[model samples]
Target chain A: MAGKDDDVKVLGVVVSPFAIRVRIALNIKGVSYEYVEEDIFNKSELLLTSNPVHKKVPVLIHGGKPISESLVIVQYVDEVWAAAPSVLPADPYDRAVARFWAAYVDNNVSTVLYTVLAMAMSPKLFDEQLLMFPGMAGVLFAATEEERAAKAEETLAALAQLEKAFAECAGGKAFFGGDSIGYVDLALGSNLHWFEALRRLFGVALLDAGKTPLLAAWAKRFVEAEAAKGVVPDAGVAVELGKKLQARAAAASTAA
Target chain B: MAGKDDDVKVLGVVVSPFAIRVRIALNIKGVSYEYVEEDIFNKSELLLTSNPVHKKVPVLIHGGKPISESLVIVQYVDEVWAAAPSVLPADPYDRAVARFWAAYVDNNVSTVLYTVLAMAMSPKLFDEQLLMFPGMAGVLFAATEEERAAKAEETLAALAQLEKAFAECAGGKAFFGGDSIGYVDLALGSNLHWFEALRRLFGVALLDAGKTPLLAAWAKRFVEAEAAKGVVPDAGVAVELGKKLQARAAAASTAA
Candidate 1:
């Protein structure tokens, strides 16, 4: 924790998609700032003071004022740097759709893909140490194979909604928010790397070419062009972390 | 369904708080618009086309483009009519907090208040007909009185978060957004009427002075000042509708 002499600074963790969202927006807007990495287990005083309520990552400190929540930070970046490629659309109606899809990404796409299966199948791990993420734990209590299978179907349904949204809203465009990778793109794109890693680890087939063609294609473009251009954290490192966690969950289950 | 000749038109149902949010924003911005009520039981073709993904109401049609989601519409109205008293704050950080609070109103205040507890406490009626509201039915299956009590306590906890938010963000202001009712006000204030009705019908003291004095005062101010001033649907009518539905839910529970 130090004085806010820096013009712009981001307080975040590496593995978090939410933090990555801020990083992507700041990069897209071409705003230069200092990046301070935080150990999520031991959150810094700066993060705590800046975001007392949430007490989480992706707090963008600009000219001494801190803005919390990833999407909010993205919108702040968009508004403050209005000249930079117009992250949100100029038209009011298009802006609404952009906002809607961005929210959809947050609520449906990212949350469901990352959190739901873990919460369903290996909830005990979450119950032990996931106090900060209250909602993510104890949702389904799917202990049995049949129960987990049913919960997996629900995750598919969630992804299916996103696929439908992509097809309907995008309407053959390069990005959901149109030609540029704007708000919706960044919101969902931050998690694409993790999702892909999960798909490889768990064989979930969330972005299965047969089921979600449009989304699969979008994911391909997002990873190859948008995310690989940098700012997104290493996918391999995250997946390794996830594997270790899954192994622990499995070990916990067997011991029980 | 008519063509896009109308300057502004809102496709919404009166009983919906989301619809009431758009109504309040448009009124605050001094924009005149035609209102079309949609039957929730049987949605119109226009509603389907306008909000294809959600198939929900409060879709604002300006010129030819239709903007879905109530908060999104409110933002659109705020952006387009930039001259009219900035619904969101002028400062970027303040704007982010406002946006975050507005979303909190949606995700926590409204959903946890009306749907989550009812769906958790009562199950049969939702099983019969609440297909569109997938999340509202059969969650937790808290059929026992003790379970219901626990869930109710959780609801109060959620409300307490909002109370904390109000106190921290408002900082002695009448509304969360500022002196006048703005984005956060409309977002949370739209449901104040419904909460009041629930308090009366169910005898639950949600806005008790002892626990949530700021929110209690805020609710009173919102109802008497912002909501009762013509744009919001009559609270009495909404309460009556809610009563009838509650009666049905009671009946369904007994039958089950």
Candidate 2:
């Protein structure tokens, strides 16, 4: 067991939004921790040992015991330092709603964002690969030109729902939970940075300022917020990295 | 706004484990709620209007306002009651761990269980469908002789991780949280009835009592616990339903 007296430590890759989630949460709560950047391509022994199961970055170590998973770490940090700026709702029901949306973003929105980015950056290769995958391939790489058009319609429908959810949740508020950013905001806000970069790169807006004004405003406010100012990665860097990742994925598809 | 004095009502389908999650949480909290079983085939106007977005069941209506999603509802029930049998841990870190596992089950295990059951009941049809959804299809269709011989190694490897997680979290305890059942148990225990039936139906023994004695014991102890007795659906009924659902799914695949 890690001793309580030892300094808190966070292990993460520099550019991952997942890692940013923990950093934002910890910073908001005013908890100071040592940040150890890991090269995911060549993982350090400490990172590997700390999160042996997932072998993923964004491992939080307090004392010596480690906790993996960004959302899990956020909840752990909230509990361990309850007196500070609370991230979760004090009421259980509200907390559940907060958690539910957070989970929804992780499961649904993330995948959509990934697919959209893949399609935008390398339309030809993405289409070819989609024909190979079973479930999503049909929808992602429709056989007939008509089928492709229909699939795009379906994709838009799903995106619209997500945009609506953001509007309803963040209506007239600086954050999802209202004026002060909460866990839900931190979770959702981290993704928005990447989406903003993707939108810039792709030149097709999913979360238009006009269509989802609240979400757009919330993103701006969140990025400008005191807690987020210095911690979040630069949008330009993320866009450049996303383009490289997309190009690499396209290359891999061609090779296969 | 609905007054606090009005009776709480839950709109959901009768046999859904998701709906039962809310029921169990509410019952444990000793909160009185009117159960309105919805015909999923013919969703009510209230159900449609209240949960306009998802239009799903297990909508918790309090003071006229509706809250959707079972996990979200459970949290709402916990908040409204705020006393009696507490479903979540008092400490935030432990509560986060419970939520993490619960979310894991919601996002992954439940989907896997569904896929496994679909495969067991209709191997041929499932194989054909697997051709369409390659990523997950490999696991489902691998039950066949030629495929099983090739894929069983990977399947077992994945299952082992789940077994290890269960052992680490719930071993030597009546439930995952020690002494008594908590959120993890309730979130997970509701699904055990379905899995138990699947075990008898498939006869493959995924939850081998010898291999995962703690999980087996926890399942037994959980379903028998006072919180679970009235809340969970009958195992016998679940077995019958499982057979029918499998048959229907198989037939549907054949028709397609």
RMSD from true fold, candidate 2: 5.9
Model 1: per-residue lDDT, tens digit, B1-256?
Answer: 1332248999987767888888878777777789999876577999989887777778998986789878888888898888877789898778888988887667555652244223344465343333222111111223454644554565567678878888877889988877888788888777766666656655555567888888888877877774337655565766676656555555665676
lDDT of 2 by residue, B193-212 (tens): 65555556554444557766
Question: What local lDDT score does residue A245 receive in model 2, on the 0 to 100 scale?
Answer: 56
Q: Write the per-residue lDDT of candidate 2 for residues A56-156, one digit (tens) a residue.
A: 76888877778888888988988787777888878655676677677656644444233443454456545444533322223323445575455444434
* DockQ-based class of model 2: acceptable
Model 2: lDDT equals 0.65
Which regions of candidate 2 are displaced past 4 Å? A1-6, A91-93, A112-171, A251-256, B1-6, B112-159, B239-256
Q: Total clashing residue pairs per candidate?
A: 0, 5
Cα-based lDDT at residue A52, candidate 1 = 77
Q: What docking grade applies to model 1?
A: acceptable
**Candidate 1 global CA lDDT score:** 0.68
What residue pairs are clashing in model 2?
A2-A63, A2-A64, A134-B132, A135-B133, B2-B63
